[model samples]
Target: MNYFGLNHKRNNISRDSLLLEIYTMNLPLYDLTLIVPTFNRQSFALRNMRYWSGRDIVMHVMDGTKLGLTPLQLAQLDDNIHYHHMPELSIGERLNEAIDLIETPYVTFLSDDEFFIPSALSSCISQLKADDELVSCMGLSIQFEYKNGNVIGRRFYQSLENYSLLQTDALERMLAHMDPYVMSSMNSVVRSVVWKRSMRLLCIGDLSTFNIGELLFELAVCFQGKTKVISEIMWLRSYENKIIIDHAKTKSFFIWWRSDDKSEDRSKLLSCISSILTKTSNEREMVKSFMLLALNRYVNTYDKIIIGKDFFNDIIVKIWLLIPNNIKNILRLVLKPFIKFNTTNLILLVAKEWSHEGVKTNFIELCEIEKVIQYFYKVEK
Candidate 1:
């Protein structure tokens, strides 16, 4: 197994063994651990198990689904795999619990349907190990969906290709993170200390509403130190709409923002971030301002993807609802040209070169991960 685990710096090793160690050290092995909190998605879980079983990295698969794998089924997995069947816990709770179990110095999260490129992950780990200031590091991420028997893919967070949170001050880091909040670093390879602290507060402070939990995580990471997004492809995102929507059953962001206790959630979020920032009352106000800035910027940016959440609440929406289903389809086709900005536009067609998951393409960079993306998009079989 290629073990990229660092810290073998003893003065006793021979040159040849040390060279092999150097070769092995290029891969992220025991130094990094993946926290996969899956809920009611055993197929994805099993696919994940199959993918990671051969790797040398440690994976804590905390399955929150009612049905978990049998003992016989678990026996097939590698010893590096640790499975926890916590059917009763929520995702946040599971994350909170899982963080404590991480023995590795570095940690990162993966959605049930997502996959990380091992080489890119190694790159992230290398950056983290090299730089004490970097609390989080990741490569580019691309979203993929199946169509016409091909794995169609595109870069969703291209802005992040050059993004890095290198601000020295905590509040400055927070402010800089909000301006173009293209994606979350929660999934990025983070130092275990930051990951645990952020996740603990994320759970206890109840920052789950109004995307507050997300803000808490990003803030906590950047609050500690720097965050880097490299040029390599890091995440393979599954944009299967049915699978994506199935997981988004929580209160919609608009509904939660409009809720009566929004302020309470906000204050709780403040406390969560403050736990990491540990700033004065006036500085805490700065964090609050940052949260508002992030919320407004985030809402304005992604509200178009809300589908009907904001518009359905409007009284004029009844006029939109009155249109016949057939007529609505025709209108959508007619207005498609005018509707320049929407979620559908992001779902562009991926080409044949991109379909080769294991091989390197001119654009898409997920390589050496043979047949991994096909786990979710099984159009081949």
Candidate 2:
């Protein structure tokens, strides 16, 4: 058994007591609900959920796939696991549905291909229960590339490595710093009340606008209360070729902005910003900072191809007009290397390397890929 110890100062319960509770299964140590939303990935979901089936936590599986697990199969897992089949609903709707059934005070979302470290979840629960002011908490996720049921490479996702609090002015500073990977459902745990309120504020839109909705909810949580960022890498994310290919193709600025469907999504994001800004003076400034960060994210998606082209007719250009010259200069300086050189093509090269499975790989190559992943979040910090 791999037992991990928590910092004694963070929790009132002793390590021996917690371990005894976990081993004896006679008492519940925390109030946490782990939600796994699965769609057409039964094998992946089942493989990952099996690890948690014997645990004391409440694990809810919202299955929306064409061929999901049967009740018999679910029963085989454990009594602690709850299975809900809602095949007609989308991922976002399934998540909302699962949220409605949560009886725990703290809730966390897990994807079919993500796994949590046992000690990390317990540590986060301890921290959240220790601090009533904290609305959410998360740790870094380590991403692994897999092919033919074999792990090819591993790297940490864009994540921080130090314990930090995002409250008061720190919230604005973190949002302004704008780490796009910082706010993912797979890597976060939030208070149920905060999650409920934030979800209610999300705009009803097409599934393509799901990311926008999630971002708004995360921001609302951060704005409403403090957020604890744990530096430990406590989650494992499985990366497949289809995801990389789709991301490479869809993340292009021209492709994302030129789509007719995205126009409505953009408008909805702006509307969300408007609604959030109406709350308080500090929140208004924070929302404005988030808007600038969002713009920078969109601009950063522009690779070498679109960076040189004139986007005079683009709606995003109007947004660029709203940013102050100082920030605009900073963005330009940040993106200049990619725009002027062939550095942006490194993504394609990495993708190509992954295409050749089981090829001889080195630590340096993996580190290069890690750098590319971190580039999205690197700012003048």
The TM-scores, one per candidate, come to 0.69, 0.60
Off by over 4 Å in 1: 1-26, 241-265, 276-370, 373-381
Cα lDDT listed for each candidate: 0.67, 0.57
Q: Write the per-residue lDDT of candidate 1 for residues 32-128, one digit (tens) a residue.
A: 8998888877777777777788677899998889988999878889888899999998888888789779898999989877778776788788899
lDDT of 2 by residue, 1-381 (tens): 223322323323344543333322223534888888888777667765666677778888888988768776677788778888888997778777876888988888777766665556666677788988877777665565543322333435444545344547635634543343355433578888877656654534442433445555665666567776665445656564245234443454346555687777665655566464456767656565665464555345444326445554476788989999999889888988676321222222332332243222222222323332232124211
Instruction: Report the number of the highest-TM-score candidate.
Output: 1
| 10 residues in a row with least lDDT, candidate 2 | 358-367
